[model samples]
Target chain A: MSAITFIDYAGVAVFAATGALAASRKQLDIVGFIFLAAVTGIGGGTFRDLILGVPVFWVANRDYVLICTVVALVVFFGAHRVESRYKLLLWLDAIGLAVFAVIGAAKGMAITGSPAVSIIMGMLTACFGGILRDLLAGEPSVLLRPEIYVTAAIIGAGIYTGCELLHLPGPVSYLSGVFAAFAVRGGA
Target chain B: MSAITFIDYAGVAVFAATGALAASRKQLDIVGFIFLAAVTGIGGGTFRDLILGVPVFWVANRDYVLICTVVALVVFFGAHRVESRYKLLLWLDAIGLAVFAVIGAAKGMAITGSPAVSIIMGMLTACFGGILRDLLAGEPSVLLRPEIYVTAAIIGAGIYTGCELLHLPGPVSYLSGVFAAFAVRGGA
Candidate 1:
């Protein structure tokens, strides 16, 4: 798989973990965990694809759905053993945010070739999944918590778009974007 | 204009009005009202189109966006005068539910030509917008209530699909679907 596609899978895995964690806290059954994980893992990308009028990524390839389901199953049993699921969730979310930001920007750049649109798409892709997770789980949104989450995604996407505009190497740009987003999210 | 297209517009307007009313209850500013209205008005069709791998209806034609915005503007200015916003909201919601159920099923039949898929599409289209509105507004979802909201949509969609299976005339099938939905909803 290409680097972007790999990162997209990683992002889906992490986001699915977060969603399953949320489901655990809600005391939902196994089916609920899977449902929540699937939505959280694919929700942002689905929205991005729809807006860009592309085939929804998971629908195009059912492997993503399988990945989410497996992650949900793992988290369902393993989550209780984690001492601080909230902290783990936050860290995993930061990683997912960074990953999705770069992947979304890369896809947007390829399709739209407009930096502004790409940046917006990146932010949407990174944040919307978490928003859906929070809303579905009835947890207070991280966005409502006065955090730097959305800003971190935007800055990461902006930096990636900037690097592309400056003719940076592909790997260099992607690494830079992910690190920047992780730093912002972690530091906050 | 086709009956389905006209009802689609009407559905958007009524759903937008309900969203604006929800915002009013939350004491949101005009911008929030508009945001909520647009989401509530277009969320379901967007989901359906996305899943069907079709161009998002509102994105393909900006007129739906305009209709949502205008309805939001009117509601922002005029909502305070209504004696029972909640009651009016319920009635309007019922109308929107029926209209969208028929429109969505019709669209599904036209595209997929499968009764089961069309009925599922109808239910999703009718129920999802309201679900989004409730989630965004932090209101308890209608689905969570004992009231017969989702069931009404399913029954409505099912009836429409049944009519089509019987090879009913176009207008007859559509009208029967809408009226059956409205009766189920209103009777509840």
Candidate 2:
């Protein structure tokens, strides 16, 4: 597989695992876990599409929903024995946030032709899934806290936008943005 | 008390009660119930405004949040029987749907310029909250259902818009719309 394809698939797995773990905390059944997984996976993209007045990406392609469902099921049932026991769930979630945040910014810049909106899209994509997760989990939103999650995503998105503006290769732009977000999040 | 005001307040109460009940089912604490209550109460309105390219209603004025919280408290601790029961809650929810459906229609018709958009706004206001509640509560969305819920909101909204075009008194227009919805829902 090409490097881009490999990275994209890896991002999907990370996001699915993060969503599945959150649902597992709720003790939600397979159906519930799958529901949340799909929402957390595509919700940011859908919101981005809606705001941009584009056809929803998932509705246009059934594969997005199917991939989310299958990945969720794999993580929910098969990972149960050591899922909650995994001490690195937060670390995995942070990686997902970093990668998804950059992807969101990249997609935003591709669509809106504005860096400002691109940053907003990145934060929305990176943080909104977790926002929905926390909201449904009935916990205080991490965004509401003084935590650097949104701030980190915003900065990462800015970096991505800046890199693209400077004509850097796509892979380099993506990695730098992800690392920027990951550093802040992992530190805080 | 004005019948309209009484009915609107009752709708708010019903929505708050349902939110609290749903939160309790998740074993959420008092704060969680209050937060979820406000989300359920004003969530639809906020969503409507967001999609309309307007500022979120509650983020500007805090009154809506306060009312939802207070109503949630009353529902959670004030009425022990209500907190424990099922059937009464269903009736309350249905009434909430009927009243709010009309109110949503009226507000949407007044704010948005087009009749079609207004009808859509009304349905969004009436149905989105419940959809969010169910989605958050591990229940499938009514939007995903073929039920008459959105259909009822749209029809009632059309009635309210028709009355607006006829230059009827605002209250009368509102009342007629409300009653029409109540009758249909009650019959169902």
Candidate 3:
């Protein structure tokens, strides 16, 4: 439980940094950076919770919003020192994507117990945040790219669901999902 | 009560048609059309509900989904007969914007009882769906356009919130909002 919680916060921070990086590219101010970061960090989870008819995580626990804001603040001040913001954004996105895919799938499985819906939820969780960030920042959406992004999320989520079906231990299943997603995304 | 409900459904239908028109411009198949239509029709309300911590409108009542699907099907077969799908889309979007702005504000007022938040909610409900449509269809977002689009929503939502503060009758407040929004957008 502690491990999952740590990874979840870490994923949000990573995603939030990507959003702040996007804002810096757009030459937006501090408020814009924070707004983009918050949306990019939690947009996918918000959508998933809405569809699942559950309380939104950020609204229920303001800590998520705080994390995003803190990350945005850090990135806003420190971004000038980072070389190749785009490359950093991609690597951070890959890490966040792997974590979020597994987390989202686990949440969906716990709620709905439907493997198909859980997989879709996992994909949405991993992908929608970046999609929202790009839309708001007016960047070309990653979805429009021919890269193997969404496929990595699917592989991660699929492996997790497969492990659950095979009655694997929790940590083993979770690690398998994360590594699968990271391998595919990082390889690409 | 019935009037608002009727207008709500009509707004959804109009927004769905605009999404279908976007799909036609992209030369997408029926599935794509339906997907875009459903998202555009319900996207704003979904965001509003999620933020307000309420059950999503379409998820609670399947009629909204049905309306979008039906509108998509109609546009799929009948689009070629229209002289200017783009013009029609603009007009329909304008109407939907008007209706949704007022309706969204009303819902927000009912839920939160805060005029400022209600006005913001109104703007979100009016504008977010089209933003989602444009984003998904890869159209330059209406938000990026230097038109009076978002301003119209603000005007409508603000007026509605002001009317509530003044303790005006429901119909008067509602019509004032809708007409103000339409006048701005249509004139633009």
Best by lDDT: 3
Model 1 lDDT, full chain set? 0.87
Residue pairs with clashing backbones, model 1:
none
Candidate 3 docking class: incorrect
> What would the per-residue lDDT of candidate 2 be over residues B16-94, giving only the tens digit for each residue?
7777777767777788789777777887777666655566766876666777888878766755565454555556666
TM-score of chain A of 3: 0.98
Please give each candidate's TM-score: 0.64, 0.56, 0.62
Provide the RMSD of all predictions against the true structure, rounded to 1 decimal. 6.1, 9.8, 6.5
DockQ of 3: 0.12
| Each candidate's DockQ | 0.13, 0.05, 0.12
Lowest summed lDDT over 10 consecutive residues: which window, candidate 1 chain B? B27-36
lDDT (10s digit) by residue, model 3, range A100-161: 99989999999999999889989999999999998888987889883688999999999998
Give the B-chain TM-score of model 1: 0.97
Better of 1 and 3 by TM-score: 1
On residues B70-187, what C-alpha lDDT tens digit does candidate 1 reach at each position? 9989999999999999999999999999999988898898899999999989999999999988887777898997368888888889898999999989888888999999999999
DockQ of 1: 0.13
Please list, in the order the candidates appear, how each scores on TM-score for chain B only: 0.97, 0.85, 0.98
Best-matching candidate per DockQ: 1
